[model samples]
Target: MAESTYTVTGMTCGHCVASVTEEVTKIDGVTGVDVDLPTGAVKVTSAAPVAEADVRAAVEEAGYALAG
Candidate 1:
């Protein structure tokens, strides 16, 4: 498995974290997602190769943007 941590912006509360987590979980190979709202960080665990672009897209789809 592969793990990565990304900085996500616009996550102000628990609901924001949940939204991102839920959306990211839908992507294939995504085993787990841990969203830290206070720090705006997202930790992801995947069974296979996962791209940063994929994670960014997922977060954007959930109404948030990946921090540059």
Candidate 2:
């Protein structure tokens, strides 16, 4: 499994976490998603290395921003 951690901005509550998780989980090959609201950290597990742009787009679709 390939795992990646990304910092997402604008996540203030559980709902934000859910939204981000829901969106990121939709990406092809993604097997799991874990969001830590307090630290704005999102950990994604996949069968392969997922593209950073794909993660950024998913986060944006969930109304968040992926921090560099």
User: Candidate 1 has what TM-score?
Assistant: 0.95
Runs of candidate 2 exceeding 4 Å displacement: none
Model 1: worst 10 consecutive residues (lDDT sum): 48-57
What is each predicted model's overall lDDT from 0 to 1?
A: 0.91, 0.96
**lDDT by residue for model 1 (1-68), tens:** 99999999998888888899999999899999998888998999999979888888999999999988
Q: What is the lDDT of residue 15 in candidate 1?
A: 88
Report the Cα lDDT for candidate 1: 0.91
How much does each candidate deviate from the true structure in C-alpha RMSD?
A: 0.7, 0.5
- Judge candidate 2 against the unseen true structure and give its global Cα lDDT, from 0 to 1: 0.96
Q: Which ten residues in a row have the lowest lDDT in candidate 2?
A: 34-43
lDDT of 1 at 1: 91
